[model samples]
Target: MKNLMFFFATALLTITLTFAISPPASADVPPPPVNQVLGLFDATIDFTGADIDREFCQQCHVGSQVERHHALVTPTFGCFECHTLTDGTFAEFRECTFCHQTSPHHTTAEAQARHCSACHGSLVADYDDGHYIPSYATSSFTPLTGGVEPDPTNHPGEYAGGCKACHMEDIGQGIASNATTHHGIGITECSWCHDVEAEATLSIRKCEDCHDVNSLHNIQADSDNDGVITPGTETGGYGHIGANADCYGCHVQSFLAFMSTTAAEPTIPSITSLSATVLTAGQAANLTIAGESFMNTSGGETFTPVVEITKGDNVVILYPLPAFTSKELITPVPATLEPGNYELRVKKDAVVSNKMTLTVAADVQVSAANLTEETIVITGSNFGNQPGETTLGNTLGTVQSWSDQKVVVLMPEAVEGQTVTLVTAAGAVDNTEITAAKATAAVKEKIKGRANKGSIKTKSTK
Candidate 1:
């Protein structure tokens, strides 16, 4: 009896195993793809639409079960295969074409038109120029098999198929949508059509567009670079002038372009005439020319924002335009500098400016009047500026006092100029134009000679 009972239990276990191991009836049909069947198993979250910012999928899948499966399999049997691809790229929702049979691009013509006509009851009658009903109609005389597709025929106002392609026509702005068409995906591409370069700008179409200054000009009234942009009461440069806004707000129109009527006769209005004349060395002079067109706004479009002044390879920056009156005044130039040849310039942002040769001179020493161990004074009419020269031989000495009349100098290395000679930094010296001052350099030279002879007794001791 015990043996028979054991045999029966064993026979029952064998039957259970056979049934469990038998293949399914439709075994000839291949099993669905693992990805298709388990594409989102235990991973229902839509990555694009999901809150990826806070949670990673591994949080839930990380466990002994997954870890055990992971040891021998590429996807660790379950975890990786479910959440990610072998390349590490998280799988997209699904290949769009898998079901749609169209380009994988988001919004094909059929998809875009899917929502229309069915849901919009009143818009159902929104028929094409033809009288044919969408459901019952056929493009050909014979009955259509599946359904006739929407046409892109050259009908008067209809542009199907490429709805988005046509809707992207100029909205009057200088920029165009990055996506060519607006059909299929309908309006979702509006967000996708971002200008990565941010080169495009939108313009206001109505009063609201104008009133919304922030949206119109993209100008925020933040004097400091802090992220917060404060709004102020006063109007100036987009904000209150004293309250962090400049005086340019209400004057947005002040970009007042340069004048246009500049192609007139070739003549400088301010320049009566130009001439060259020699003046005593160290003399001061100014270059002047008159032209009323610097304020001309007619040629404004031709001038861009960048401005620079150039003269025969020499260049100077003239940007960040300064205030100037419509009426003329002496224009500012680079000044208070050592004497040298200069191209006198006056510019409005450099593109339009008056220029001329401006000669500058250094204080020239003409002759010596007073002599001392530490100092030698010169007597010359232009001495203050053309201060007199004092030299023992050839080397130039340090200048002390100068005026239009006489000059005094402290000798750096003693130079004896017994014979008066003129010299300049340019190497040419001699100003016959200078008048004698006080005791006069010639007479002073004679007196110093006699003094030197009498003082020869004292000189031997040194």
Candidate 2:
């Protein structure tokens, strides 16, 4: 009876070992639940909607275990993946310090460099300075894509600034104005983003991302008191002026460092042509200069352009004060210019353009001459709006009427082969004349021996 009882016990033990060691009867047989204590896990934490935060993690991990995830792996695993109480939200990144000692996560330079990749490798895969993860204290900033992708074509350098510039509380005033925490990253504390060994010169070259180039904050105030206000100036060209809040509260220091380190290539102004080659002296001339990159807005910036006219031993600078465009500038050339040859050029700040030749010639030209009964009408250009004087070969003619293009003077007591001359404010000159009459001595004798020096006399209105 004892042997039979022992045999049954051995057989029972054998059957138990076989069941435990055997493979599943079929692949369809469902595997065990991922969690051993599935019932307790379900009862403790609701996998559905819940406002989860750092305090909520304590229920399972107890004290520090809540923050014990590998710091390097956290970004990949993502706190929200398991902190599953909230959807699309993670505990403030500052809470990351509870378990990971950021003060000295990696001791060596090589190790620290590698350490930087653990968190930033995935976040900045595309060099997107705008990448951000919302904190439990704040809702996720929407459309998390479309951040500034700095490259050689757009934003030449690594100008993402730092994570705190847009993702930290109090500091992220540009786009992360609603940010409640640091989102787990410190801008200055991270050796990779800033030079913790020295005065923490920023590595990614930020601020211009959201403020100047991005057109979001458009902070173009002259905060540095330099009097020059434009994008890429000494203060990153984004000042606190007119800001709804103190925009410089965080940017003042970082931006100064950025400008000092990076050199922005100025858009040099160019000159293609000038509208007029000759300008009248003693008369204002509207001169239009065509070019590229002529800055006019908020004038007084360093790149403001001015026209420089240089004569043999003198120079005249003209500013297009009232208004101008990037492609053209119409400025009144002062009447003060003397009659002479001059070299004209456009100067943008200190950059000078190619020289163009301009002549300030005597401003007068004779177009035609006609003889009316007892008067000679001289038609030409630049005949001074105000009446001047007219002469006919050693004889003075009585001025009948005078205008810029047509000047009529009573016929002088003259004869054939005589010359007619006009004198105006332009200059004392005989630059214009009428052809001598072909009439014979008999015709000259008919009218007191006077022959019209130009066209045949018209019938007298008298």
Candidate 3:
């Protein structure tokens, strides 16, 4: 009787101390249930062990502790309400759809489909109809997953495709288990093989690790010349499994495609300088791109380099040529480009270069001009490629030709003293004055000779 009384007192004291240390409840905490004698050891009548139910746990776990489990329960419910069925079995034991079907707490369809039928096995089974996924068994001649497998009859101690022939497997080799285990959302994606496969999965690899070049897959060669062969995709066709597939056909075609999937040695491009960074809008300029490793030629055929200019949502792709080299490209900036800050990038096929800034200024600037008779040759920057309205005073002049640097205007009605204006879409550039052109020294000499002749005739006549 004394020992029982002491045990009850100790339990009561422990409960009191727990409540004192814990924070106050945010919500109304239910009163603690009276503990029956011997109920601390065995709570339920079945004596299956301590009841893993909800009400039994709330005795000490009052206050904010109530929110820890009930937050997801949404009604006046607890953990056991959703976790366990009435019959004592788990809700998941019925079906994954039981809880995951309509629950707002489930992952999206894109998240599930990304793993290749992890949650939906029936869909994957439909795609495995020999046409999509071939049999790997020796009884079948064409095996999809037999990339690394030795085929003595076909190639004599030769392995077939590459590392991706297994790691990217959808059907065989515990597909769902590997997908959920390796390709978890926000943790790891499908691009791991092409990116950080070797370094990431050094020991705990999803597929069998590549040992050597001569043994199974001849993949020690860094095809991209990036000095790293772990992420197979960047290494060229030699690394990325998708590149080695039979689609590029099976048998002899497959072998050719697999052999041809070598990533060219990577030539990283960088922009060193641009001939002009800031130009007026609607003013075309000969943009010279000086960079390194812009491989503009291959096998004597010149490659058409694409200059991508982006401003906000606007992207303008221009093809530059006639002056294309490994280090330099001379492209024309269109006069129609809007005035804004633009980001320029050079792309050689799939290889993209470094980013460079280009500013399309709004205001046009006139530097110098020469006026001869009614014709005015306005020389300045940012006059635009297309002829715009050129006015001598208020009278509009007929533009003979227009260029970014110079504009020749013929205005028969134009006076010597008049402000010459060049108007473009961007803005207008005006010369302060169109002064009369000075005569040459030869014209002055001719007039003096004529006067001398007249004086001589007059003296002879007298």
Task: Report the number of the highest-lDDT candidate.
Answer: 3
Better of 1 and 3 by lDDT: 3
lDDT of 1: 0.28
Per-candidate TM vs. native? Answer: 0.22, 0.29, 0.27
RMSD for all candidates, in order, please: 39.7, 38.5, 33.4
In model 3, where is the ten-residue run with the lowest total lDDT?
5-14
Q: What is candidate 1's CA lDDT for residue 213? A: 22
**Per-residue lDDT of candidate 3, residues 172-271 (tens digit):** 2212222343433333344432235455432212222212111122112223433233223332222222233322211222544343334333333445
Candidate 1 global Cα RMSD: 39.7
lDDT for residue 287 in candidate 2, whole number 0-100 = 65
lDDT of each: 0.28, 0.40, 0.41
Candidate 3 residue spans exceeding 4 A from truth = 1-268, 296-302, 364-462
lDDT of 2: 0.40
Superposed Cα RMSD, model 3: 33.4
Query: Can you give the lDDT of residue 121 in candidate 3?
Result: 18
- Candidate 1 lands at a TM-score of 0.22
Q: 42-131 in candidate 1: lDDT tens per residue?
A: 112233543432223323221122112222222123233333343324454333222334333335553343322222111111122222
